[model samples]
Target: MKAMRDVWGQALVDQGAKDPRIVVLDGDLANSTKVDKFAKAHPERFFQMGIAEQNMVGVAAGLASIGQVPWTSTFAVFLTHRAADQIRMLVAQTGANVKLAGSYSGLLIGAVGKTHLDVQDIAIMRAMPDMTVLAPGDNTELLAMMEWANAYDGPVYLRLARDPVPDIFGADYTFEVGKVRVLREGAGVALVTTGTQLSRVVEAADLLATAGLNPTLVHVPSIKPLDADGLRAAVGGHDLVVTVEEHSVLGGLGGLVAETLTATGPAARIERIGLADTWGESADNAYMLNKHGLSPERIRDRVLTVANQVLASHVG
Candidate 1:
């Protein structure tokens, strides 16, 4: 297992060897965002913009104007909150080929508290016109997305976590943009999740199976340009569709799934598992996750209950 940020930084360093137009702009958080490796390997292509996240976006915009694929690296909160206006105007509106990497996503910033952690970045980035949103579940998926982002056009937001995550994809994994990967096969229900939340939900599937729920595990890596066909197939005809994310229930994967499914009703009932319309707090990562009902045991229990209720409804 490796941190997705580390995988991304390494991807930049490796890809930079071949792609000269790839430039890395950091908001004085190279080490935290794991772009330090790229800085060391390709100093000529790395720009350090100290804590000025907005200026960093402008600089990246300028680079993009010249056809350079400039990737701005910073915390998810700062990139979305601090430089949103600049990103919206200079990057998204202009259709600049700028890649924005929002590291340390979700409510897992360790002790950084609500101010540092980003609980709604997915919603914010997804709202931007012409913006492509992606959240890779593990090292393999992160590497694939970085490679794709380096070549894709327009504004792209890559959400990543700072913590080490389990390996969900193997060596031969190929990532398709806007496509969701079905991780396991089962019956009756689909347990959908994305990002680092994948491993836990994979476990939750097992727990559900032990309880005779027979859940189909789903990993929705691409939150925007969603895999509509894949999503429909996953949720179609199923009694329940459980969407889990490290983000809020308002406008993350849950919202996207709900919107897409409802548009093509009669859709399956959705059970969204994510943060509420609430801010984060200063606490240990485990404590915060448990408090927010994101722990594996909590997720398992929640899925189990939902499965039972659905079964009972059918019986009735």
Candidate 2:
């Protein structure tokens, strides 16, 4: 298994070969962000914008105005927090055909701690009017999203985790923006997940099934422009909707699912499994995941607890 950024960088090079309108901009972290691959292959189309995150975003906006599909890559915290104002005013407001690649997102940055981790990026990016926020389940899905984003018009935010993840989608998997991937079929509880958290969610689904929870596993690849109907369809008939992610429970996948259910009035109760608007600390990936109740075992336990509760309520 390879990192999502690895697939993303190579995919950017592949897309560049086909689309001449594609341009890449890096925030002085090309090697770390993996955009260095694109810079080496297409130096003329690649722009090294130093460490000025805000200015780099501005430059991407300018390039987008001239019909170039500018892809800007940087650390997630820096790209979202450092350049939020520019992103809101320049890219989202104008609906520029720019794609923002936020690398090292969430608590997957191993020992980088909270200073570099981005836990609120999905919430911030999805809140934008024109931004299409995506968190691919694995590297293969990441490649699909990159190709789709290349052909897609307007602003997009690609949330990439730095950790290696298991392949959940098969070779025949096709990416549809705002669509969910049904990983497993069943009906009792729905395990809706995004990004690298999918690995744990899938494991949790199995554990839940062994415990007789009978979960329906679903992957939400597109958080923003989320498939409301698709989510409803996958989550329909389930007693509980458990949204999992490496982000905050407030405004990421959990919030988006809640909003959709509210708009449609689904009778499922949501138990958000993620950091509760808290910052991460310097620790090993497994330690951090366990600390935040994101481990597969923890998720499995949570699902069993919630599923039992719903079942007991029916019995009562």
Q: Pick the candidate with the highest lDDT.
A: 2
Per-residue lDDT for 1-316 in model 1, tens only?
7777777888899999999999999999898888999999999999999999999999999999988989999999999999999999999999999999999999888686668989899999999989999988888888888888887888899998988899878899988988878888777888888888998788777877787778888888888878798788876778889898889999998999888889865787789988878887889988987877788878888877887898898899
Clashing pairs in 1: none
Task: Compose the digit string of candidate 2's lDDT tens values, residues 144-236.
Answer: 888899889889999998767899878887899988888898887888889889998888888877887778888888888877888888888
- Which ten-residue region of model 1 has the weakest summed lDDT? 203-212
Candidate 2, residue 205: how far the Cα is off, in Å = 0.9
Could you give the C-alpha RMSD of every candidate to the true structure, in order shown? Answer: 1.2, 1.2
Model 1 residue 172 lDDT score: 95
Off by over 4 Å in 1: none
What's the lDDT of the predicted structure labeled candidate 2?
0.89
Which residue runs does candidate 2 get wrong by more than 4 Å?
Answer: none
**TM-score of every candidate relative to the true structure:** 0.97, 0.97
Model 2 residue 203 CA deviation in Å:
1.0
